[model samples]
Target: MVARYLVSPHGGRRAHPDISSALRAAAARRRPARIEIAPGRYEETLTVRGEVELTAAEGPGSVVVGRTRGSALDSFGSVRVHGLTLVGREADAVGCHTGTLTLDHSEIRAHGGVALHARPHTSVTLRDSVLAHGRALFTGGTGLVERCRFTDAADNAVAVLEGARVSVRNSRIEDSRIHGLRVSDAHAEVIGCELTGTGKAALMADARARLTVADCVITAVHAEGIMFIEQSRGTVDHTRVTGARHGIGAASGADPVVRGCVLTDCRDTGINVQTEARGRFEDCQVLNSGNIAVFSTDGGAPEVHGCRVVGGNVGVAVIGGARGRFTHLVVEDLTNTALRVFDEAGAAFAHVRVERCSSGLEVRGNGGTTAEVSDAVFRDVEMAAVAIGGQSRVTLKDVTADGGVLGFGVADEAQLRVTDSTVTAVSGAGAGALGSGRLIARNLTVTGSGSLGVYGTGSAYVDLARSEFTDCATAGASFDEEAGGQVVDCAVNGTRGVAVAGNGRVDTVRLRTSLKVVRHAEKPAGPPPQIINIFNGPVFNGPVRDIQVAWGNENVVQNRGENVRNENENEADAEADTGADAETGTDAETDTDTDTDTEGNGSRS
Candidate 1:
């Protein structure tokens, strides 16, 4: 049997005048006790040491327990408080120390301290309650907070520290001065919750904390919606973050896995991974980001897969010696480059598609930067589909670029190797090498170019083999202004202009069908242009011999045998140097001007 006691402010029959007298009488009993209080104000602190239940004779908001200092209610054993309002001015409203405390349908408010505090070895359950200030769970404190409201917190709404385990479900934490939920060196699970209007990040996990958040909405935060730092690890799935500074941030070696999340209208980057952090984002959508959709810097190596980024300034950026692997990514309506890798960074992209962007992929650095793109498609890009500069090296295989201003733009001593790629419907040259850049293309095809199909200028070099150029408005292959290279076993057909034209040295061997070389009249003071054509065409095998032509003041055509025909007017000073080998030549001139663009060079922003 349980002992029952009634407490009333006014003395009555068999009724205690105050709660202290009733609790004193119940303490003498050997059984559990129940204290029923009338609807009035109780201005005293209480401590419970045995099994007890405190109830209001009426319902919630009918009883008020107010204190000026210290906790209004402290529990050392099993205690239950229902339908009562506990308010404290300078201390915690309710505290549980080495005991179990259950609060249901109650209101706990603190003016200058925590609203609810659970010390080590304590278990607290807050259901359908409201916390005005904050709640803290220290080491070894376990709790369940369900269907609760945490509002106007002086600090973080809920803080779990020192290995505490807590679960918050179906709760609303809003208007927090700091983070809505902070976990340090602990484990927390937040499900089906709403965290809004926070001063800082909505959820922050640091000091190697482990967090699992699912089906949550975090919006209108001042900082990152969710942040993981200091080697913390977590999994956030099916979460939506809107109107935050940054949607998610991981730094200082933190490695979190975020999947199936939507981040929209972020003030900055949707996902920021920095400081050697290696996070993985899968099947996520970032829309209308103010800046880059995903940014990884400072040695951060993030893997983004199956993600869609729409309406951002830049889709993904990897710089500051960081590396990233982005696969199956679709980026659209970006104002800048779809993917940018710089500052000695390295990146690999496969099965990626970029559409309606200013530029497709850019790889630039002082040195030691590399990028590989394979099985990628670039459509409707405003600038070059692939731009490489600043001594960076890039390779493209099995890639297709359509409806771009330039297919590939290489500059500033950069090296680009393209194999098994196709460039079509480009407004500028299909591939251009400028400012001492080097290009090596094999088995490549370029069609429907407004300018030359392949061009090398400004002391650049291009080695083309087994390539095909068709429907080019300008010459198929051009090397101008001291640029020299070799074109072997290539076919140039359906060109509106000549097949080859320039003032640079070119060695053409076994070119398909007929070949036309046009030399301009005005040439810079340099070595004379030379062309060594060694042709033994089985298709046109009738009486054509090797020809060597060196240009000196006029168009030149030299025939070694009587059967060969001169397609251009033979000049007096032109020479037929048959001893010159088509496979060997001196190095081209070194150009110091890095900003000069060729006639069909792509524009750089």
Candidate 2:
């Protein structure tokens, strides 16, 4: 039915009174019916049952369908509407009934209720159209929305659910009272879209939904910018988000991958991966966050690498039995702790640098917690830097803590192995060990402290070997009653008080005291216990040094602490090349921070 009708105001000669009647009579066209109506307001409930094209008789934006009681159109077959304005009240403008609906250069303005809704297996397409002041499109099938504008929508701009596949490209949605784009048990692809002033998350995927958002900009979201929860998975690529509560979040077994995104000025955590979820964040820059910049918690293990987090209250906090790995990170200028791990959680940090924070690197666990850390550098912290407590067995290697009030503190039942490290406390002390903890500081240098270099109390054992301490106000190192240690080949200078004071047996051989010369400390009166060089206060009373003395060239004499020693003149002379390298050799700084009750050999039950 190739028909043309003129409206009342536009010179009507042979015209239909209503668009619905014209559409019904024209449905018998072999090809799609083409009915051109003049530009005017028509009042009817149009129910289309066949393929038809209802075009404007004059031009675009001139045909109007107004004063509708229910939906303007109920489509059961393919319907294409061009250059039309549909204004409805208390009902949807277009309801698709198991058919395809296409709108071009159109506008749907509803007072109350949805603008367009498609049932199961029904699709909808909007090209250069606007849906405003309504609960916008709900898609249960494939939905394609391009170059559209959705504004002041009371509910979600687009809801994709029930196994639908939706694509929205080059669109803009603003001031949505609910979520801007919501997907549940569906898949959605949003590209080159801008969403702003959303009351909820700009994009939300839940209940096995798989979503991908690329080259999008979202701002002023009251909730998270992007959310993947309830076993959903998504990817956000090259997106920019600002002024949201949370920038991106993955929870409830969701595994989202966020790559090449810039998140700034979030009210809460910038990136939150929680609830046993495993997310990957790569090449992201998160700045000026109100709370934690990156948070991995609730037994989740998120991998964050090559990221920069700056100016948050706390940066990169992993809690709630979570385990994660942070590599090649640069976090700086935080108001509080830069890296915090707590609540039976573990985090491995490699090649991390933290600067200008109140504190840095706090690892805490109550009963069963552990972690491995290596190659970390902290500088210019105001409060204590690197506080480890609460029964956590942490291994730190090649760490440098410089210029802080209290350099490091280990308390409770924590076991910390600080190896190949340097601690410089310009205003305070270095390494406070308390509460029956075990601290092994090997090959470490502590310099320029205003107080004691190492303070240990409450049965804590402080092991020092091949370490150097200088410019101390009080004793170089002090241990209270019941604390024990062995300091071998350590150089200490400028201690105003006693060089070392403790009730435990301390063996100081070739140790430099306040006199700036290497001398043996006079052994205490009690007989030495029975252990050999492993240092258990007094373990070896007999001749502990082995005497298989076949003397050789000094250069070829490779003497390790595990080797049996002999006291021949040439061998003794060869051993005296400061004999410190054996105890100072690098112990392998690698261990898993987990909740299992496994020993050092890493056997899990």
Candidate 3:
């Protein structure tokens, strides 16, 4: 059985005049006690020892317990307080040490110290209560805070440290001074909570803390909405963060997984992974970010999948020797490059779509940057769909560039290899290599280009094999200014200009019908002179022999007393300079003429 005691300000009929007298009277019962206080103000502190139940006779907000110096309530055993208001002026409102304390339908306020403090070996549960002015500290205990309101805290609303375990549900922590919830070297789970107007990050997990935050709203935070640092690990799912400097950040070897989250109107990057941190962001939406939507730098490599970035400066940036992998990503309405891999970084993108961006993808660095893109689509991009420069190596497979200024641009000692790709409806050359860059393309299709289908200049090298060019406004292929390459088993049809035009040596073999080659008037000043080797002379419309043009000599070789007329007579002379037999179609030996095949069968004599 339980003993019951009643306390009233006016002592009457089996009632104690104060709660202390009542508690003292009940303390000798050697059984569980229930103390009911009347509607009055108690200006004393109470220390609970045994299992005790304290209730207000008139319900919540009717009984007031206040103190000026010490804690209003201290528990060393199991205690339950209901329907009361506890206030402390210069001390903690409630303290639980090696005990279990439960507060329901009450208000706890402290002016100087913590509102509620749970020390080591303590268990605290706060349900449907309000905490004001001071924070709740759990140093080494287990706590459950449900349906609570923490407002105007002088410091972090709630802090879990020193290996404590805490669970906060359906709570509102608003207008906090520092972080709303700080977990350091502890474990916490926060669900269905709203944290707003915090001075710093809404929730900060550091010092190897483990946190799980789900179905939470973090808004108007001054810094990162959720930060995981110092090798901390956690999972944030189904959360929404808005109006923050950065939505989520992980640094210093911290690796957190963020899924099904929405970040909107962030002042800076939506997700920032830096300083050797490796995080994974999946199925998240980042909208209207001021700068990059997803950024990984400083040896940090993040895996992003099934994410969408709408309205940002740069969609995804991987730099500073980081390696990132992105798949099934969609980036639209960006003002800058959709994907940027720079500063000796490497990245791989698969199943990506970029629409209405300034440039689709850019890979550039001093010497060690690399990128690989496959199964991608670029639509309505204002600039080159893919740009490579600065000694970077890039490869594109099964990619489509539609309605862009240029399909692919390679420059500055970069090397690019493209296979099974299509460039259609571009305003400039379908593909170009300049400034000592090298381009190797196989099974590529270029159609509806405003300029040459393929272009190379300035000591660049181009190797095209088994490619097709149709409906190009200029020549199908052109290499000039010491640029040279080989085109093997290719076709050029429906071109408005010549099939091939260049001043450098280009080897063309096994090309399809109506093939034409035009040499420019200016000759390159080096060895390996300008030469066009047409194997098996019957492949052309007329009987034409292989033509080798020496430096300072403009001529077309004659075969069987017939001249292969130059299509553009104003550009270069077509007369035979190398004496050949009019009947046998054999040319005289010259120092530069190294052709050993005399017969028309494309074999050495």
Candidate 4:
């Protein structure tokens, strides 16, 4: 099937001294030639066999192949090289081993080692090519680079060694100093690529490699955006990795699978699996990081779903022999310990959530481990939202911690179970620091706490039911220094509510709630002149608990028409209880202010 044959570098005749001796005498006259090569310097080395074809009379920088010393092209059968602009090369500019070598829209620049060196069963194809100044010792071999663009490559711009299987699509491998994409004992398929200006690892795999990266966009890398060493196996999807120090680096028996990725501005860890590594991250988004965003070690098994670990120094860092499982996760800004379970690790958290954090969770010195935190939500934590040290076994259900200073801190025999939770606005000091414990909280709600909401230090057995504690400054429920706790249908608001000092055993707590006192207007006796409630409780019906004030004489003279005749006799005593539900208590009124008390008058004191 002789379809065409036309070889020229200028005139013909065993082809002249120009055009690489007339394209090496029309490709040694095996006859299927298409060697064009016009416009410029062509130093030498253009070895080809039959079925030859080398074009570029005008495309890339106008057909220039000026390799002053070594290889320009050492292709085999069925070869096709278009739009050429291959300059200085001392080693490999193009060295296909067998057949089918096709490079389109080319420009292979200055090289000491490799620009392209396909060996075993070669079928190299590079499109829209541009492999810049590459310095190498087997830099790029088994190739298939589409929409190619590899800039300033000093070492390892692409090296798919050992039983190679490489395929990079929509490429843009930027300025590399060391490793940009080096798959060892290879198998790679990086799609929609953009391995940014890297100095260290933009992509690297060792021994048992099998990488499958998709929709990629890896940013400025100095260390690792994707690295799997030893027994490697990687898979990153819908990726986006920002300035990296470490975005995903699995060591040893690696198994990485991160989906829907976004690891932002990292300096240390966004995802690091060490030693016998294993990983799985889905729907990920890890923001501003200085340290750990997700780390695991030796016997690892990392599994995180619907993840988001915001501004971090330590968001999710599990140490050696790590094991984890997190669902619907959200670990917020952490300066230290957003969720850190060190050493002999084990973790399992569901519906996990945590907000503005300092220490949302920290179970250090873990052994055997067991943390089954459920339906979690911890907000604005500054100190302790949860801190269990050592021998793990923490089980918290329907957990919710708000504005925390301390929510749960169990030190020694860390074994806890908190059900249906709601710990709101816990202020200042240690609010609930139960060490050496066993707590079972039901329908709990500890609001505006200052000192202790529930503090049992040491040997304990707390079983709180229908709990509710409001605006506390000092003690709400404190089983001080150990032992017993069993409270049902509880409710305590403010100063020294329930304080069982030391050896404890408290039972009866059923206070039916009924107190609405609002009567204060003395004033002119000194300087206490404001008492404004305006509309407190029962108005029509008679559950009127208070508002008592009957002081006679001594310059006591009220104006404003005697304060509307004392609220029209308390609204006719709330219409005598309004028995038939006649919109009961519909006209409440209680106001006694001589002048002003700002904040626009909706004040509660």
Report lDDT (CA) for all predictions. Answer: 0.79, 0.73, 0.80, 0.65
**Candidate 4 local lDDT, 1-605, one digit each (tens):** 33333444565554344555555666666677676665666666677765766776666667677657787777777788888877656788777777668888988875666877787766687898788977322323466779888888888788887676778898888888877788877787889999887898898888888888988999988999888878888788988899999988887778878898999988988888777777788999889878888887677677889989888677887766678788999988776667877656878889988888766876655447667788898888776677665466667777888885667655555556677777777653233434455666777777776544665444555666777666654444544333455666665555432322123243424522222111111111222321212111000010011111111111222222233445555555422121111111111222233322122222120
User: Taking the tens digit of each residue's C-alpha lDDT, what string does model 2 give over 554-588?
Assistant: 11121323323344522333111122122222111
For this target, which candidate reaches the highest TM-score against the unseen true structure? 1
* Residue 400 displacement (Å), model 1: 1.2
- Stretches > 4 Å off in candidate 3: 513-515, 521-605
Model 2: pairs clashing at backbone N, Cα or C within 3 Å: 370-593, 529-538, 529-539, 530-538, 530-539, 530-540, 531-539, 531-540
* Clash pairs detected, candidate 3: none
Q: Which ten residues in a row have the lowest lDDT in candidate 2?
A: 534-543
TM-score of 3: 0.85
Task: List model 1 lDDT by residue over 274-318, tens digit each.
Answer: 999999999999999998899999999999999999997889888
TM-score of each: 0.86, 0.81, 0.85, 0.42
Greater lDDT among 1 and 4 belongs to 1
C-alpha RMSD of each candidate structure in angstroms:
9.7, 12.9, 11.8, 16.7
Q: How many clashing pairs per prediction, in order?
A: 0, 8, 0, 3
